[model samples]
Every structure is written in structure tokens, then in C-alpha cells.
Target chain A: MRTKTLITSMGLFAMLCVVIFGLGVKGLALDETFRRFVLAALWVCTWFAAVVGLNRAAASDRNKSFFSALMLLPFDPALVYLVRLVSTLVWLVITQALLVLLAVPMLKFDFFSQPLMLAVALMADVGILALGVLLASATGRLRGGEALLTIALLPVTVPVFLAATGATEALHTGSGAAEAWPYVLLLGVCDAMFLALGLLLFGKLNEG
Target chain B: MKAKTSNAPLITLALAALGLIGAEVTLYLSYFYTPVQISAGTLYVVTPSSGSTINLYESYRIFFIHLPAAYATALCCTLAAVGGIAWLLTRKDAWQALIVSASEVGLATGAIVLLTGTFWADYAWGSGRIGSGWNWEPRLTTMLILWLAFAALLVLRRAMDTDKQRAMMTAVYGILLGPLYPLVSKAIEIGQTSHPKSFSDLLSAPEIATTKQVATIGILLALVSMVALRYCWNRLGQRMAQERAA
Candidate 1:
């Protein structure tokens, strides 16, 4: 069932991407920058939907066979979180790269020259996902888990969003990587701190 | 249910009230009576500056609210930690009460700090200069997260039917991770945006001698009054719970 769900979701995501790309090409053919923004927005929404879908799949009792497979598999939960983090990071980076690609034609400057922006975006996403997964795990145990998790996670993720957006904008404006490195490092440090703290406290939460 | 023959409550109340009053007087003197000075194209009129002085209205004036809130939040968190530790050691109801009260007050003060800080940021950084709306300043960010954590602690307590379980969990989290607040704040400070330094620089020489002194006293009094009222409410709550159990 989990495999089915994952496949269905992936298929849906692919379709959504194709539709967005088609729309971008048809309507905004000459406006590459605008196309990039639209594509990035679609990517962000798709990633969020995928996470919610996967979480729902995990919680459903109808997936007993899949649960057994998951249990038998050698993959650790932490590794699962890490992989999810990586996937989300890749999605965001792709969106960013697309934005830069389109911006090059419009802005008359090299948008992708600073590779560190991609690294920074990835770090920020890691911090965000770590915090998100921890809250989701906690809230998922409760009755109104998803709603509670949303409320609990949104405000906490504000800083990460701010850092990510600021650094991204700075990079686009042709700022040196060294200039924006501090914010990226800050995001990385926050990610590690929260991950460690969550792991330490999660055991207690699970018992209850 | 008779009162214990201890002056501890009275003393605490008095000290807290005194602190509040002192802060208030300092605020008055700093703004109303202090001389205004001009510096570098900006008019430096202290809080409650004289009516005639062209007050640049350096948004730092909001520090009157921000500083007290910061101090109160820090105090409450510390109290929560200490109370949690005491409860763990002694398994006493009084310690649990202390933890609950501290957490409540901490949450309230944290909210106030965030609000006032936003106002200050709006004035200093110009509205929407940092990020779109909210800037990822370390102090603001961590204070916010700490507030959420306390909120979670309170909700968890409410959700649990048994007092023993509630107290145990609250104590465990409070004592174990209380230090993380400062640690996280410090790391953010080192890694990210530049905000005011939290330590000694918070109270400058003129600030201490002037309107800040009055504001400090007023805040202390306000906090004392608030805590006293909360304590009374808590006592009533306990009595009702006991009556219901009986």
C-alpha cells in the first residue's frame, strides 16, 4: 500500500510539473524570470504535498503489509529523515537553479555564478525539515496531529525562512559567497542543535 | 490551611514591588528631567525628553518595555528550572506550583518582549527592511521558540489528567533543557545577525541614572503585582481541585 501511495504521489507530482512547465512555456515564453518564479512556487507546493501524503500513508492501518516491509528493511528512521531532507533540498535547489537560469536572460548578469547560494538553501532546508519532522512526530501521536503540528512548526520555522530568503536574495544581487556565508552557517548550526535536542527528547515523547 | 509563620512571601512581594517602583521613577527622570543632546545629525533626546527638545524618537525608547520583558522572561525561565530541579529532588507540590507559575509568567513576558522588539525593529530597521516582514535576528528568533516551548509545556500539563504525570514531565523537560535557551541564543548571535549585546551593555551609565531607572522600578512593581495575583489564583485553583477530589 505504501509503495502504491508513493508511486501515485510521484506520478501526480510529475504530472503537476509537466502542466506547470507547459503553462510557463505557453503564456510566459519570453518572460523567463516570471516563468522561473511560477515554477519555483509549484515545486514548493509539490514538495509540501508530498510530505503530507507520505505522512498520511505512514499512519494508515491499511498499509500493514507495507509496514512489515518497512520494519524488515534495514533503513533507520533517522536515515529516513535525512533522505527526506536531502530530497527536499534537491527540489528547492532545482527551483533556485531554474530561477537563476531564467534570471540570467532578464537581469543581464550571471545569477548562478555563486554556487554557495545553493549550499545555503540546502542548509536552511535541513534545519527546517529537522524541526518539522520532530514536531510532526510529536503531533502525529495526538488526535489533531497534523493541525497541531502546523501550528507548532510555522512560527518556529520563521527564522529559517528568513535566513534562506535573505541569503538567496543576496546571492541573486551578486553578493560574494563570503558575505552570505554567516547566515548559511547559522542555519546549519540551528539544524544540528535542534536535531540533537529532538533526538534526546524524542525517546521520552515516544514512551508517553 | 492556615498560613505558615514565614515572612518569605511578604519579603518577596516587597522586593518585587520595590524593584517596580524604582524602575518607574527612573523612567520618569530619564525622559522628563534629563537634558537632551544632539549627536551626528540625529537628535538624542532620552525617553520622556523635555517637551521643547526635538526628540529624534530613537526607537530605542521602546527599550523601556523590551528591557523589563527580557529581564522578566529570563527570571521566569530560571525560576522554572530551579523549581523543576527542586520538585525532582523533593517530590513536593510547592515546587510544581512554582514551575507552573514561572512557566505562565515566562510565556507572558516572552510575548511582550517579542511585541516590543518588533516595534523597536520597525523603528530602527525601518518597517520591512529585514526580510519581507520578520528578520531572522537570533535574540528574537530564540525568544520566540522558547515561548513556543513553554506554551507546549503548559498544554501538555493541561492535557494530562493526572497531576503526578504532568508534574513529572514538566519537571523533566524544564530541568534538562532549560540551559538550551541561552546556548541557542548565543549560537545564533555568533552565527547570524547583529542585534544589541545582551549582557552588561543593556544598562548604560546614563540609562541607569535617568528614565531607565524609573521604567525599571515600574516594571518590577508590575511584575510583583502580577505574580502576587497569579499566586492567589493558583492557590484558589489548588483548593478547588482538592475539594473536587475529596
Candidate 2:
């Protein structure tokens, strides 16, 4: 049953991603305003996915043993969080790649051609996903957790969003990548801060 | 058995009254005594210019109130973060109350900052060059973030079923975002937006620095006194609720 649920959810999530990204590309191709709108949409959806996924795992009887076994391990609890973070990043990267692929044909922007752009997108996704999971886990069991998480996530994500958007726009315009580098660096710093805090705090939150 | 009531609320009220009086005095000094300084053009020009280019904007009187409100908001958030850290380390009820009180006040003051900021932005940058009042300038953007974060913190605390869970989560969230304050300021400095480089820029001349300094100190005291009053009120409310349940 757990395996079935997991597979079904994964399939549904992928289909949803395809539809959203496809429509986004078809409608808003090559428009700077639309690009920003897309970025905002991506952050919201990614955050929702992280929270929903974590809540489901916590709810599942099957995952209980998995979490417990990891908790009882000789290693530090941060390792468990680190593993979860990595797995989430992997899933996020796959969805991002799909979106990029869908946009490439309609928008004529190739993620493969520009490795720096690709790196920025991937890094930004990891940072966002990490922060999302940490916040989701912190608030997931409570009443109105989802709403609270959304509100809390917005303010924290502002710097990351601005930096990521600025860098991507610079790359797309093929102008002033030098100017964009600072934003990219800022993005990296934000990501590191999120990842480090997530590692340190996830265990403490889980304990209670 | 007879119950004894604590005098904290009365003391807090007195402090709050003093703060209100101080704020009014500061406003009077700023408006009546000080000469208003304004940047010639744009809402948030960060560059330093020679004294000749300085323009007098009577509307610039808003700076006195705006700066104090901004400072109060920032200080309250800092207090929240500190209270959160203390709670995490000790798991005490006092720390929880401290955070809750500070956050509530922080949210109110943060709104003041945003509201007054909009007026100042309009006066400085809204007309002439941009025609629009809003800019994604770093300081304004950061304050918006801070306000939202404070609101979220309050929501998160209320959403929890248990006090312990609420306290723990609040502490973590507070500490996690504490770094954001400094990051925002650094981003503004590096990005260089329309905001003036220093509060000193708002002063008319070097001689009036004494007035600015005293007014600032007065406002800071008033803001802190208000936070203390809020903390006392929160504790009083909690006690009343507990007694009713009993």
C-alpha cells in the first residue's frame, strides 16, 4: 500500500509539473515579466511540494519504522536530516530539469548550452527545497500548518528569490554576467545558511 | 486563601506612558527646532553629495518618527530572537512570554515603519522621476520581509496544539531567521539603492547633532518601555486564562 501510494503520488506530481511548466512556457515565452512570474510560481509550488511530501511521510505507518531505524542509528541525527535533504534535492532537480526541457523548445533557452545558468538554477532549487523542508517539518503537525508555512516561507525566500531571478535574467539577456555574479554569490550564501540551519534544527524539532 | 496580584502591569503602564510622552517631545523637537534636509531628486539616492546640492524638504520632518519606528521594529525583532535563543537553551516559560510579547510589538512597529516609509518614499521618490511610490530598494524590501516574518511567527505559535511544541518551533524559526536582518542591510549596502547612506544625512547641520542624538535616545527608551509593557500585559492575560481554567 505504501509503495502504491508513493508511486501514485510521484506520477501525479510529475504530470502536474509537466502541465504547469508546459503552459508557462507556451504562454509566457521570452517575456521578462513572465519569467519573474514563473520564478515566483516555482518557489510557491516547490515549497508546497516539500511541505506536503514531508507531512505524508510523517503520517505514514510504513515510514515510521524507517524514521525510527534512522533515529536509532549509531551516527548523529544530523545524518538522517542530511540524507533527507539530499533525497529531496534529487527530486527537485528532476522536476527542474523537466521544466527546463519543456521551456527550451518554446523559449529557445537551453539549460545545457549555458552551464552557469544551469548551476544557478539547480543551486537555488536546493537552497529553497532545504529551507522548505525544515519549515514544513517544524509546522506540519499543527493546525493550519500549511497556511502558516506559506506565510513564513515567503519572507525568508525574498533574498533568495531576488538573487536567483536577477542572476537568471542576466544570463538570459547575455549581458552583464559580471554584474549578475554578485547576486549568484548572494544566492550561494543564502543556500548555505538554509542548508546548515536545516541540518542543525531538523533533529531538534523531530525530538519533540 | 487570598491571592496577591503583582504590580508588574501598573509599572509597565507607567513606563509605557513615559514612552508616549517622550515620543511626543521628540516629535516637537524634530518639527519645531530642527531644519529639514531632503535629497534633491529620487526617493532613495544613496550617494553623498556636497552641501550645496542639499535641498530642504519640509516633508522631511517625517524622518524623526520614521527612524524611531524603524529602530523600534528592528529592536523588537532582535529581542524576539534573543528570547527564542534563551528559550531553546533553558525551556522556561518566561522566555516564551518574552518572545511572544516582543513579536507582537515588533509586528505593530514594523507596520508603522512600512506605512511611514511609503509616505517618505512618495515625498522623495514617488513623484517627478518614477511617478510610482514603490521601489524594490533593498531597505524597504527587507523591512517588508521582517514584517512578514514577524506575522508568520505569531501565526506559527498560535497554530500549535501544545505549549511546548509552540515554544520549540517558535524558537527555531526565530533563531533561523535572525541572520536575515544583517544580510538585508549588507545587501542594501552592496546593491546601493535610493536610501541615504546614514541617518546623519537627514540632519540640517553638524550643530544639530545633539538634538538628533537626544531625540533618538528618547525614542529608543520609549520603544523599549512599550515592549516591556506589552510583555507584562501578555503575562497578565496568560495568568487570567489559567485562573479561569482552574
Candidate 3:
């Protein structure tokens, strides 16, 4: 029940963000200025919604003593970090899918038509959440943790996000896979780094 | 364990002195040794009375301060990340102190990198507009992000309550910063169409290259001294925290 609420709220929040962003660029045609700006705008709003969702989810876990329950378990805490990342990934996947579904028409971009860009977006999510899970846990237990998590997470992920948007743009324009593959590879490198750090350091997030 | 020597202050003082000397030599060489080839500086009239034949590359002199700060920024970040990883493994207070001190120094040097970079950008790429010292170039953007992350780490490091929490949080933040520099470095190999590359061509001159090497060494020494001094200060705080806990 709790997880359902989080998924719904996060999905709704993402929709709200996409709608606001759409309003900011209202009346821009599909193949004109809209195409140029839509890719970056969509990714930014998605990441924004993702960051907020992660912060809220982590906060609730701590508040309800779910974190304490996990800490008391016999298994390694790093496993908890991985499990939470997977669970967060699942909820975010649902919410973000809804967000993108809405994004397709309002933004006038055939997001579903491009399999490559969708792959890029999914890869981008791994890097974001991998670092996001660790930073969220580290900051969520503090005062003003929500704001700090967003502030801290965004800058660290800028390079990957930049590459994600660039790759998405390249693929959307009918560019060949060869041209866009480098950006995808960069995303992979960052994702690996983030995941490795999460697995290595998640156990140290909050002491036992 | 043996009693530690009281030479820390003297050692720090010597490093600071060496850094100062390096700065002095670098500046002196930049002005007097390097030949002027660009039409980018105050044009010296070649009157028979004046010994001036070539124009000085005044803006190029920023490389001395700029390159050193860039090197120091990278050094401090690497130190912080290494210290953070070591702390996580060993759980030692000195390692914790090392990350904190390195982070503070890195933040200072990162700001210098941005400020100095803007100066270079304006001179090299600006269209003679006021407040046009910066653009959204890829490498510049990467540097800015790295600087902002440094600031965020220090800020978040303060919000933790206990010693263990602070150390752990800071270690994670520092380690989080680890992959970013390399990623950006790699990313710049593509899509960096606008960064000024003429400066590199000019650096083939033996004088400028040697001067940069000297300046980098000197500035790194000063920055490292700062980290060491800060580490000592952080160790003092750690002792107080332990004493209070006892």
C-alpha cells in the first residue's frame, strides 16, 4: 500500500512537471523550435521528478522505521541498498512511463517511435538512481535533506545527463547509430562508476 | 607509537615559501623570458628609441596562474577521493580529516579555475561585449559542474550530526565526485568545437612549456601545504569530539 502511494504520487508529480514545462514552451510547433528544445526539457523534468521522488521515498522509509528494520536484519546493508535501488527503479519506471506517454502528444515528439532514444533514457536512469540512492540515504536523515539531495545529485549527474540529451537528440534526427554510439558509451561508463560506488559505499551510509 | 615531531608548522612554512618562490619565478619568466608573437596585446611602437620589436601576449600570461590552479584543483580532488576511500576502508580519523581538508582546498582551487578560465575565454573568444567572459562551452560547463559539486559536498558534510555520520557522508560525497572528472575529460574529446586551441599550438615554445611546468609544480606545492595545514586543524577538531564523547 505504501509503495503504491509513492508510485502514484511520483507519477502525478512527474505529470505536473511535464505539463508546466509544456506550458513554458506552448505554441512552439512540433518540427520547429519545439524539436530543438523538447529533448532537453523532457529529460530535465524527468530527472527533476525522479530526484524528488527518491527524496520523498527515502524520507518516508526513515520516518516509518523501515530503515531501522532493514538495519537490524542479518544480511549485509549493501544488499539493502541494491534492493532499494531495484524497487525504486521499478516504481520510477512506471511513473516515468506515464510521464513519457503524456510527453509524446503534448510535446509533439514521437518518443515511442524511437527505440534508440528510449534505450538512452533508460540507461540515463540507472546512472541517476545509482548515485541518487546513495546520496538520498546519506542526506535524507538530515535537516533540509530533500533540498540538499536535489542540489547535490543534479550537478554530479550533469555530464551523463548532457550526454543522454545529446544522444537522444542525435537519434531523434534520424542520425546513424555510429554517430550516437559514443554518447551511449559515455553513459555506460558513468553508470558503471555510479553503480560501483553505490555497491562499495552504501553500507557506510548510516552506521549500524 | 613514537612521539610525533613538532616540525609540522616549520614544514608547512617551508612549503608555503617554496610555492611563493615558484610563483615569483614563474611571473618573472613569463614577462621577461617568453617571446611575444601575437597581435593581441598593447602594441609597442617600434621607434628607434624603443628596444621593443614584438608585441607582448599579456593575456597569455594567465596560463601561469590558470594552469597551476587547474593542476591544483585536479590534485585536491584526487586527494579527497583517495582519502575518502581510505577512510571507508580503515575508519581512521586522520583519513577523515584528509578528505575534509582536501575538499575545502579543492573548492578554493576550483573557484580559481572557473574565474581564471573566464578570463581566458573572454580574451580568446569574446565578441568585445561586457560581461561576455563566459560561454556554455562543454569543458567550461564541466568545470563549473565540478566546482558546484565541490561546494555541495562541503555544505552537505556540515549537516550531519555525529562524527561517524559526518565522516561516512563526506566519504560518499567525495567518492561520488571521483568518476565525474574522468567522464568530463573523456566527453570533451568530442563536441569541444569552441574551446581555444591556439594556445596549445603556441605552447610548443620551450620557454612557455618550461615555465608552465615550473608554475604548476610551485602552485601544487602551495595547495598541498594548504591541505596539510587544514588536515592538522581537522585532527584537532577530531580530538575534541573524541574527548567530549568520552
Candidate 4:
């Protein structure tokens, strides 16, 4: 089910946005700042894709198969959250990897030069997917929940977006990893905080 | 029939009245008594246009409202999270009431902070140069994220079909909203921000510091009053909704 949502037009929709973003910028392909722009666009598109994936995943489970089964589980609810997070995270990572691959060659940028950028980006993915899964589950079963998912997910991920983009920019701007560490640390902290909340609250959400 | 919801308890009424008086006094003090401050770092608002600078002279008054609203936002966020956890543990309606009330109030206060903050950024930091100064400063940016989370809580609440679903989602999201408060408060410290870096500069002037503190406390009293009143109304409203559904 998750794969179905991922491969269809919505996935292309996000990828298309990145194409527009890249092509829309005049002379960006030749410019040195192209990599940074590509990173920024990638982050936005990745977030959009993650939100769509999360929403679709939760909607598929809306008949209460997931939660009802959760009720009968022998293990703790937090473990349930972790399991779902990992599943969502895997898909998001794959999508992002595809994006990075596309942007690196099709857009022609040096991603391998600064490996930390990818590290920070993947770390941010965990945070976004962690919170997105929790919120998507909560809103998925309700009427007009799709609208809520988009709106709620967009704004809440701003900090993560900022941190990822900041670190990317800093790394590519000739400052090296030294200037980017603060942002990376902040991103790590946010990721941990969101994951902790997901583990703690997603369980309570399943309880009566 | 819908039950009567506006008859607040005596303590709330008293607090509201006291808050009103305090607000008035704080406004008076901030406006008329606090002298114009020119601290070292805050002394100039450099206009990027002509390479000139200007004193924030009169525009700094917005700080009184800006700071307090931020304080109230943090307070309400904490309240909502605490109430949410309590509700989760006990499954009590009163705890749910507190959760909704604080979320609603927090959204309002967060808006005030954002509005006044942006205005201050344009006028004081930009030196009346429009759209030049604040371009997603870390502090303001993160605070906006926090505000959006509060709004998301409301959206989640409205979307739920059942009361228990609403309560459970709100509790979880409200708790999720907790970490952002610390991030907002520390964003200035941890990174580059367009906001006044530290209160040390603003605190140098005894009168300004005192007035600022008085105004912050005063506004907090008024906002707390609002939160309490809203919590009471929320409890009554929940009961009415449950009755209507039944």
C-alpha cells in the first residue's frame, strides 16, 4: 500500500517540483551556488514526499486494522511506534536517496565533496518522518484529515528544514564542517526530541 | 439544552479584575515612566539603504508587549502539555478542559508575539526600512514553528469525530509541542538571531528594566486570567457537547 502511494503521481508531483525549482532558476546550472539551491529544493520536496507517504500510510490503516491489532499486541505501544517509524523512515530515505542521486548528476552538483551534508540531511529525515507518522496516524481517520496533515506537517517541520539547509549552505560555503556543527547539533537535538515524543505519545494515542 | 457557560468562579473574576488593574498600570508605566533606552548593542538600527543608523527611540515600546506575549506563549504551552499528560493518566474531563483552553490561549499569545515581533523587527531593527531586517531570524522562525504546532493541535481537535479521539490526539500533540518552547527560547543563544541578543543590554537601565518586568508580569496576569477563564468555559462547553451528543 505504501509503495502504491509512493510510485504513483504524487511521488512524481514532488519530483516535478524539484525539476521546476531547478529549471526555473536562470543560469543556476552554471552557477556555483547550484548545489545549495538543489539542496534547498531537495529538502522541501523530501518533506512534501514524506508528508504524502505518511498520510497515505495512515489512511490505508484507517479501518482500524492497525490500532485494533495494536490493542491485541503482546508488546508495548512504544515499540509499535518505533516499528512504524522505521518503516516510514526506510521509505523516506529511499526517496531522498533517489532525489540526491537525481540532483547530483541531472543537476550536476558535488554531493560527494561534502559528505556531512548528506548525513545532516538523513538525520533530518528521521525527525520529519518520526513526527509525520504520529500526526498522520492521529488525523488519518478523521474527515478532512488530509488537509490537516498537509498544513500541520508543513509548518512543524520548518526548524528541521532550516537546520538541514543551514548545514548544507554552511558546508558548501567554504566554511567547512566547523561552521555547520552547531546546526548539525541542533538538528540532532530536534530529531531526538521528536523521536522521543513519538515514542512516548504515539503509545498513549493507541490507548483507550 | 445547552448549559450556561459564562458564569465564571469568583476566583477567576477576582483575578481578571486584578489583571485589568495591573495591565493598566503596566501600560501606564511602560508608556509614560520608562525612559527611552540606548544600550550598547541596541543603540543603533542600521538602515541598510544609505548606510545610516537611527535610534529605536520610540519603537522600542513594543518590547513590553512582545516580551510578555512570548512569556505567556511559553507558559500556556507548558500548561497544555502538563494538562495533556494529566488527562492521559487520569482520563479526566477537567484535564482535557485545561488542554483545550491552554492550546487556544497559547495560539492567541503566540500570534501576539509574532505580530508585535515582526513589527518590532521592521521598525526597530530595520529602522523603519520595510522588509529589510527580519528574514526568518532563528528565534522568530522557531517561535513561528511553535505557534504553528499550537494551531495544528486545534486542527486535530476539530477533525476528530469522537470526543475521546479528540482528547487523545490533543494530549499527544500537546506533549509534542513541549520541546519547541525550549528551542524557541534558546534559538537566539545557540545561533545567529536578529533579536536583541541578551537582556543584559536592556537591563542596564534600572527604570526600563523595572518597567519591562512590571509590564511582563502584568500582561502575564491578564493572560493567565484569560487561560483560567477559557479553561472554565471549556469545561462547561465539553459537558454541553457530551450532553448534546447523548
| Local accuracy by lDDT, each model | 0.58, 0.69, 0.76, 0.77
Candidate 4 Cα outliers beyond 4 Å, as residue runs: A1-14, A26-29, A63-67, B1-8, B36-54, B127-130, B241-246
lDDT at residue B57 of model 4 (Cα atoms):
68
TM-score against native, each model: 0.65, 0.84, 0.89, 0.88
Regions of candidate 3 where Cα sits further than 4 Å from its true position: A1-8, A27-31, B1-5, B39-57, B128-131, B196-200, B244-246
Could you give candidate 2's per-residue lDDT for residues A23-123 as a string of tens digits? 75675556666655554555555555655655554445233556656666776767877777777677666655555565455445345654687778777
Tens digits of per-residue lDDT for model 1 on A1-208?
9567655555555545545555655555345465345434533543454346435643562235443444346666565555544554454444444444544554333434667855765666566666665455444444655655555555455556555655665565456666677667666766777676555443333332
Of candidates 3 and 2, the better by DockQ: 3
Candidate 3 TM-score for chain A: 0.92
Chain B superposition TM-score per model: 0.76, 0.84, 0.85, 0.85
Taking the tens digit of each residue's C-alpha lDDT, what string does model 3 give over B1-246?
113424665677788888878888888988888777556333321111122232224667777888788777887778778888888888888888888887888889888888877877666554555458776666777888888888888888888877678878888888877876775455446664345433445566788878888888887787778888787678778777788989
Model 1 stretches astray by more than 4 angstroms: A10-58, A61-126, A157-163, B1-16, B36-55, B58-61, B77-99, B121-210, B217-221, B224-246
Go through the candidates in order and give the C-alpha RMSD of each one to the true structure: 7.2, 4.2, 5.3, 4.0
Per-residue lDDT tens digits of candidate 4, residues B65-141?
88888989999889888987888889888888887888898999999998888877776664534356556667878
Task: Give the backbone clash total of model 2.
Answer: 4
- Scored by lDDT, the top model is 4
- What docking tier does model 2 reach? medium
Candidate 1 interface RMSD to the true structure: 4.8
Q: Model 1 lDDT vs. the true structure?
A: 0.58
